[model samples]
Target: MDLIQRLDSRDADFASQLSRLLAFEAEQDESIDRAAADILADVRRRGNAALIEYTNRFDRMTAASIDDLEIPRADWHAALAALPTAQRNALEAAAERVRIYHERQRSETWTYTEADGTMLGQQITPLDRVGLYVPGGKAAYPSSVLMNAIPAKVAGVAELIMVTPTPDGTRNPIVLAAAAIAGVDRVFAVGGAQAVGALAYGTETLAAVDKIVGPGNAYVAAAKRRVFGTVGIDMIAGPSEILIICDGKTPADWIAMDLFSQAEHDELAQSILLCPDAGFLEDVRAAIERLLPTMPRADILRVSLANRGALILVRDLQEACDIANHIAPEHLEISTEAPEVWAARIRHAGAIFMGRFSSEALGDYCAGPNHVLPTSRTARFSSPLGVYDFQKRSSLIQVSQAGAQTLGRIAAELAYGEGLQAHAASAEFRLDKP
Candidate 1:
């Protein structure tokens, strides 16, 4: 009964209770931030020397220079070839699907001429270079490599540089294989805030990147926060979250396991279920109790479910949609008879898994959609990582003399209204210039 918070929409304090359960203010540990700041500063000041020093001290490497950390192109190809047949095939399959999906998102340079001969349009161009940070050591996730790198390549990025820590000189072959499959241009065996700093501010050998992507530990997040202006970065991600709206038709066991998918992510991750049927809620509770002990990360699941997870009794599917919009969770699964009907009613969520068959886990790996999504209720305004994130847009303006006469007058009027006579003169000069 105490596994997770239980709430009823009929209760007077239900809204307040749900708010408290959903609230998650990630710890801004000043110490970690300060440490990250110091590392970034050192790397920016000393370049390759600082990068090698941190790589040696933190990852236990004895590299003499930058060349020692740069993984050769042939090594990436070797890793790809060395992968077991099934693993290699799966990585390629995932990469191909991601590429296909993101290729549709690539924007092109477009322009249209007006009647007055003013050509206006948006020109889309890929970044010159980008940095991808992959978590190394025991947290190697080859899937993440596909999710981050494939989109950049699909966006026509010229160069994709990947930096992953090799703790104790142990490189994750799977990650390397993924990078090769994703068409990454380069690989470096370095990580941490130092890697981020080196990417943002070029080292002696490594050129600076225009943008950086991929997920990492707390230090990586802090480093991204510090280097936002110097280089474009993906969002500062928060703890994962999953919310399921079941109409009691789906099996309770299915719903229970669905909740466990995100809960297993970490102790801070959250999972919640909204159902109109009280009996089904209890059935899911029993299923959670039965399945929790069997999980390898049962301890983490217990802490996560106990602290942030919830089972709420909503008035109906309509009310469930309303509550879901309020929560704006990272992942939403509409497990019901007609998920589309309810999905249409919903307005906010990072990714929606419709029907009983569409699980959130599938979306995380190979659902043809980018898994790097907005979190911490950021779905309200932000979006998942895609080719668009790797591309930038510039406005095209070619005004003919006649067209300029009109546009210039408008601009000059506004500029003069804001109080500058020079602006008015500029427009007046162009008004009748032969």
Candidate 2:
């Protein structure tokens, strides 16, 4: 079998082939959904008792009470202090960069008054509390902690609560240290649907959060979806995807590694390249063959690349840009001579890495943008998580008497047209009688 799929825009069946490649229908597993719903209901009904039962059974914990799952603030600081100098420095640096970037996104309340003394504005306020879920099973992503929590703190969230599964009672210290660095108010070792339930429906020990933001596995994702109405949730991200638009001027090795970055994430993750040069495409193909063996995640890279990755030859840079708009990928790398020229044409993407040197990996770490991006073509409408997600806006209005005279008439007329007598009467009540 070929190491990875290859296609040409000139092919007659190319459109259908590209559609097939992009198709990633997340199967709604009824069984999983039911299980999650049951767990949520249990948590909602029994509260702390059910929380302890599920945590103990699923994560192999022996907690006598919900209090047992709470990680002390002292432990968070101690985790920070205990980190090796290099890791600690990198974590702090990444946190600071993320904080600085998110601060720029903080929404502020603004008001404007008309000549008639009518005032209208939007009032921005932070969420009272937020829940951050960090996946703690396969790998410890301290970076997830930093990305999810720092933005909430930057938005002036009053309290930040974190939940991560500590399977077999094993907690990842780095994640704890990140909690300390990110100013997380509380850390709970409970995870899975139970943790999400606890966050959405407040328990005796853990209060319900205004919103929950983070990534998780199948059950956790299903749980997030189930509890969305009870508590706001971040996007249910699909497999990570990266689309690179190369003018075939960048190094083949660089392009290959960039593709590998997302592919190595998992077997479902996707990476693709769009270039005009056939010769350069071959060079990148050769580069992928040469470098795949050296990666620690070569097996995952191999499977993901073979299954979902693609290399396409476009007619020109403009064509590549057009195709990128069609895909609306989560991560876009415009690795051409004048990247901005093509990036300007892009209508949609979660994040655009301009120039060859700006690898997607950098953005995942200290690059000052949230790596939690909209995946699976969701970039067409949604956006990356930021301070904006942690805060809400309320429309402010204070109508002057003269303004009400006009607005009330309009409102009553429309209300009466709709046959809502109460609404019409309410509006008419504010008007001066003839």
Task: Identify the candidate with maximal lDDT.
Answer: 2
Whole-model lDDT, candidate 2? 0.94
lDDT for residue 234 in candidate 1, whole number 0-100: 88
* Model 1 agreement with the true structure over 235-257: per-residue lDDT tens digits: 99999999999999888889999
lDDT of each: 0.92, 0.94
Lowest lDDT 10-mer window, candidate 2? 135-144
Residue 321 of model 1, lDDT score: 96
- Per-model TM against the reference: 0.98, 0.98
Q: How do the residues 235-347 of candidate 2 rate in per-residue lDDT, one tens digit apiece?
A: 89999999999988999999999999999999999999999999999999999999999999999999999999999999999999899999999999999898888888999
